[model samples]
Target chain A: MTVQISDTARPAAAGTSSGRSLRNLTYRPEAGALIGTLGVFVFFAIFGGTHFLASAGTAAWLNVAAELGIIALPVGLLMIAGELDLSVGSVLAASSMTMAIVSGYWGAPMILGIVLALGVGVTAGALNGLIVTRTNVPSFVVTLATLFGMAGLTLGLSRVITGTTSVALNPDPGSKAVFGTLIAGQFEVAILWWIVVALGVGWMLQMTKYGNWILAVGGDKESARAAGIPTNRLKIALYTGSGFGAALVGVIQTILYNGAQVANGQSFVFNSIIAVVVGGVLLTGGYGSVVGIVFGTLTFAIVNQGIYYTGWNSDWASFILGVLILAAVLMNNTFRRLALSHAPRSGKKA
Target chain B: MTQPLLRLTDVGKSFVGTNALEDISLEVHAGQVLCLLGDNGAGKSTLIKILSGFHAPTSGTIEVDGQPVVFKSPRDVSAYGIATVHQFGGTFQLMSVGRSFFVGVEPTKGWGPFKRFDKGLAGEIAVREMQSLGITRVTDGKRLVGSLSGGERQALAIARAVYFGANILILDEPTAALGVKEATHVLRIIMQARAKGVAVIFVTHNVLHAMMVGDHFAVLIHGRKADDFHKGERTREQITDLMAGGEAMADLEAELAALEASAGSTGRS
Candidate 1:
């Protein structure tokens, strides 16, 4: 009897080992994101005409994607760890205003202004982490509170310090070259920064011990705690990383534009989330990938910019985005179900 | 007559005004399967909690290899090579098998500034451990743990504990939800662990499963040790009656007999 049972199990295990990579693709976490990216690129490449295929047209979407990708990557990480940071928008605005007021209005050194701006983001993020971990409050609520609170602080402080909501900046040549200058006078240098952030974050999530802890925490917090993982600390660090990412984007925009406004970053609040979800991340947490988030950012950017090249009606951009979100989520749901139900095919029922 | 792997003497725990457990004493040596039997609300979970280091005893002492030690946390207990596997294997369902196996203590390779988790090593080890536990269907450690059957998950948890050098294994109703075949597989794995010299604490409400592998048995009833004996000292019916709470079994039998007699006469009429 035991021999029969063992014999029956062997073929199934061996079956999955051979020629299964193609079948396995349907179960991969980034499968939906990959498909969505390709589908949208094809959609835009055809309807967007010759100009959309040009280098400048490509840079248009890439620039938007680069900025949003930086914020989306960490936000994706936060989401995978089972938390949400609704305050990235506020962090961005606050950081932008801080840099402008410090260097543009107060005439401080450019480096000092940059450091202080990033510091504001880290502080806001750490505060979000501390409040969410130390108390029973959900991260969504805590970050929402931070979002409004930081927005008020930035707006009020900008008005008080510069006597206006907007501040103009004349960045030092060095700072401009690293953070603001365009490549070949076409693409923002932020693209390079975005690539670096993605590589680092990807390494952290895929090849590090902490990545395992993050997934375990998101999968089941109680079990992760029982396994002796420092759940709270991991969550705090993820939130802080996201804070830094948002602030980096703020600094990039402030330098690139040569000015900052109190209301410059509010669009990022929903845009970053849209990019993350459209990339195939689970909104509730525990199943996502850096590759998927990147693809998601690109998909959002292509749709956002490609519509402008179509020259139909810019008003249709939001409509397409709304349909895209529903489609991506539904696609992700189908793949996740495939993943969960993919048990080995033994003779007996599992 | 070597020292028992784990010994509990006069261990008691209190919560507010109620004693969850009282003066519970038990001992098990390496290579032994000690089955803890009890009814619902019989302090079985409390005892398991105290043993697993989730709760500090309010009184008495727990000794390991003859040295009394206090376990203020699960980490402290794990350091003593005491591991617990709850129902459904206490596993992360969404994580891959290799990843779940090494959640807290991941294996790494390469030099500093380039250190990375050794995915191949982790997967190989996880797969080898599961195969050793007779889980032949799970050949790929990259498979998500959620994809494993209930029996396979339990085997994975046991394999993990053994791989991590657990001297004593505390399983909380490991076979409660398993079918006959799967339950038998888990029982076989438990025996395999016993053969390898790891002390096993098998907690269950099922009397038959307790008899199959249990070398020694202890029954808890209402925060107290009601019985303790070696194998063959009791019959299956006697064990079941005790687990159902002593006199309730006889009362239930008599009530059933009376109801049958009345129904038979009414049906004939």
Candidate 2:
């Protein structure tokens, strides 16, 4: 509910830098993300030459981007709900283990493995949510605690039971075609999953009752509580969604490589957050979109792998990513101010 | 068909170390607006919260339509036709006007996880509710509430309350921070709500607005009632005085007595 109230109609329309108040131009978050996207593409296309546009190269970068983007979608939704899930990595590991132990180890049916994996993810998410909702601690601290606890459990249980940090799986032929196969040689079916999820999440964020409540909780918890939104329940769902996101990623990776690793998905913790924010989500809560997150993830992937295609040092990838995130965020804030300058100005008695 | 919509008998509330309300009693009959006025730090908020079932008073009981009830949450209050519209309007601004209007109890279709909000039904209801409140200008249910004025948000809050079958409403400072125009708009909606036979307990410091809309006025000073009056017994000046602390009146009495003694001494000289 932090609406900027400024009437931009009365401003002097002079085109001078000093005369043109930043308020006159309505810079939307979508606009900023779009512009950043174009900027990154032009920069890479000029420097990286044919490889940046090569279908094989595009697919390779998109493969990584698809994985990151899938998780980012839910993470963005969670951020908008004013909550976080530090335990996503553990959730991913646990989900993969469920699939590995159930199908590969126990020789169970593929459907059972899929169901067990999803169930494990949902349960872990619910537990995190229940603990956070019922407790008075900040979600940052609470989720962080769950993150460490689940990681320990994932590792201990893996070593004691699976007896190794990783598990190799060869899916049944039926399962491979249905859930694991690559489509069109280049695009992983996971990309389609990512795309469908993005569309669905985006629509939900914009159109649904739950979507509105998510923004409300993120914008102000107390106000959402007063509105009788069942903010606690909504937050728990958000956590559960985050867990579900991680689990999906785990399933995709397990299918892609036909294996499960306890150490996988650690990088997602920060990468997903950056993708969400770069896409225009406010860390403070209640702003941004699914499309923006998708663009942000693509931009990151392009920068990460694109650096190598340009024959530059791969180490420069991290540095470039840091810059891109910072720059996109700065522009996003600027756009927010611009978009808001036209609103009805407050503090005026008249 | 009509028993008193809501009743509070010997309702008392205690905080960690202090009694905010002690043996306080009030009744909200249908179609009546009761304004609860108080200075800062008064127990108006506490009283509102209790009526909304946020905090069960340490001692005392409450009744709705002559039926004694114990409420564990605000949802329980809703079952009894009581809803609270706090100062913030308690809405999601990024959400569409329609969605914010029908949160929690949204009309859903399909089955299980695939269930989606019935947008057409929601929009129709939102439009009708808002129109009933005479907010006819807002036609686009898809518009985000962040675009609405402060008064519009308040009216929407009230409309949402009535739409949800709340017969008794507890509004917390509906116009405390609004401008003249927005506040006037809210007053208009309050009048419409009154016409609908809803019992409203309005909590505010604006005696003028209270006099305009409220059928009864109760003033709380330092967690206690300084005075209670109907439209005839209270004035703008009287309510303002009680709100400034009872010490102001005592100081005025002492000054008047000292002046009388000086006048007498001068007459003798």
lDDT of 2 by residue, A1-350 (tens): 01210111011011112343343323334556656766876788779888776766666767777888878888888888877777887788889887887777777887788888888888988888998899967778887887788788888888888798888888877767656777778767776777678777866875566776787778767766766788888888888888888888888787677878888888888888888888888888877767678777877777877887888888888999898899999988877655433233332322
- Cα lDDT tens digits, model 1, B1-269, are 78899999999999999999999999989999999999889999999999888888999999999999999898889999999999899998878899999988899998786788887899889999998988888977888898888999999999999999998999999999999999999999999999989999999999999999999999999899999999999999888888888688789889989899898988862
Candidate lDDT scores, in order, read 0.88, 0.77
List residue ranges in candidate 1 displaced over 4 A.
A1-21, A343-350, B253-269
Compute the lDDT of residue A98 as modeled in candidate 2. 78
For model 1 chain A, where is the 10-residue window of minimal lDDT? A8-17
Q: For model 2, what is the error of residue B166's alpha carbon versus the real structure, in angstroms, after optimal superposition?
A: 2.6
Predicted structure with the largest DockQ when compared to the true one: 1
Docking quality level of the chain pair in candidate 2: incorrect
lDDT of 1 by residue, A248-316 (tens): 999999999998999988888889998889877888888888878888888898899999888789999
> TM-score, each model?
0.93, 0.83
